[model samples]
Target: MPYVNIKITNENVTNEQKKALIKGTTQLLVDVLDKNPATTFVVIDEVNTDNWGIGYQTVTEIRQDQ
Candidate 1:
């Protein structure tokens, strides 16, 4: 079994976008690794900009500073 996890900030990505990411990545893993699509799993997490960090600052802070 192969596990894949991806994280992205909550922005323009919609619910459908998240579903597509999971489906596409799973298909790729199945085709290239010869694994069952059912056995592959993907997790998408939507985080607030204030909760996510970059360097020593939160994403919200960085965006404001820029």
Candidate 2:
């Protein structure tokens, strides 16, 4: 059994989006790596935009610039 953990932080990510991401990523890993879905666990951790930083800038701040 292989365990996988995934962390993603995005201001636009909703609960549904997180669920889809976990499911999709897990499926991909299982299909590509031939792992068992039942034994494979995927964890998605959502972080606040203020806590996430990119190049010394907050994700929220960066998105604002974009």
Candidate 3:
């Protein structure tokens, strides 16, 4: 089994986009690793802006500065 974890900010992401991510991730494992789609797992973690940070600044703060 192959596990893939994808993390994104808690921005407004559509369901269709999420589905595409899952499908694409699965396909990538199938094509590169020869993993079975049935046994592959793809998880998306949507983190709150306050909980995610970059360059020592929270995403919320970065966006606010922008």
lDDT of each: 0.89, 0.80, 0.96
TM-score of each: 0.82, 0.73, 0.95
lDDT of 3 at 18: 99
Tens digits of per-residue lDDT for model 3, 14-37? 999999999999999999989999
Give me candidate 1's TM-score against the actual structure. 0.82
Please give the ranking of all candidate structures by lDDT, highest first, separated by commas. 3, 1, 2
Q: Across residues 1-66, which tens digit of lDDT does each residue of candidate 2 receive?
A: 776676667557788887887789778878899888888787777788889888999988988899
Model 2 spans > 4 angstroms off: 10-12
Clashes of 2: 0
* Residue-level lDDT tens digits of model 1 in 1-66: 889888899888988899899999999998898989878889888889999988899999988888
Worst 10 residues of 1 by lDDT: 37-46
What is model 3's C-alpha RMSD? 0.6
64: Cα error in model 3, Å: 0.7
Off by over 4 Å in 3: none
**Cα RMSD to native, each candidate?**
1.4, 1.9, 0.6
